[model samples]
Target: MTDPIPEGAQEIIHDTWEDGAKRSAFYTLDGQQVGYRSWTAEGQIDMEYGIQDGVQHGVFRTWHENGQLCELSSL
Candidate 1:
């Protein structure tokens, strides 16, 4: 199960490469990214990480809306 989008996520950005790889960013109303996810052309998750100051830097994690942990990594 995928996590539900965070409450108050006001802006989202999406980018797709020529190869069909995709990246998506979720942001707060103030424009701070709270989460990000990227997938390969084959539709496999390359990374699902968090952001601070528009940079991936901290305890990156993914979880379901029910609070099940899917993945975690520190950068």
Candidate 2:
């Protein structure tokens, strides 16, 4: 499961489709994006994807705060 947005986030960008699917990116207070998540209309995670052009790109992944891999996939 994707973690909640961290506290002291400096910025956030969010988009929602007509069908209710949503995507969001979270950044640290210092301005580096720390995470990305997407969810279906029903609120299930559609994917945990990478960021490019302020959106999901080729592959999706999640990482620990200490930089360990949490999850990764093309889907």
Candidate 3:
């Protein structure tokens, strides 16, 4: 199978739908999105995704809604 979808983007089925939510994962820009997300019963995002660069080639950080550090990852 193809490599897993990148970290930031997801695809959704758009048949008769205005939003693409049912589609599976997708690529975000050219890179993978760097975090996981928590959702509510209604499918709203609750927590941010946690992600780190697969390599130590860049700098990055993830934060909570209150601006607290959730994770510090580098690529």
Top-lDDT structure, candidate number: 1
Model 2: pairs clashing at backbone N, Cα or C within 3 Å: none
User: On lDDT, who's better, 1 or 2?
Assistant: 1
Model 2, span 1-75: residue lDDT tens: 333334565546488767655555455544556456655555555445444445544556665545566667653
TM-score on alpha carbons, each prediction: 0.46, 0.40, 0.28
lDDT of 2: 0.54
Worst 10 residues of 2 by lDDT: 1-10
> Which candidate gets the maximum TM-score versus the true structure?
1
Task: Report the lDDT tens digits of candidate 3 across residue range 1-75.
Answer: 222234335533222223534322222434555333343334443333233464222334445555565665444
User: Candidate 1 residues 1-75, lDDT tens each?
Assistant: 233235566646587767755655465546567667665555555556556676775666665544566677677
**lDDT against true structure, model 1:** 0.59
Q: What ranking of all candidate models by lDDT puts the best one first?
A: 1, 2, 3
The Cα local distance difference test for each model comes to 0.59, 0.54, 0.38
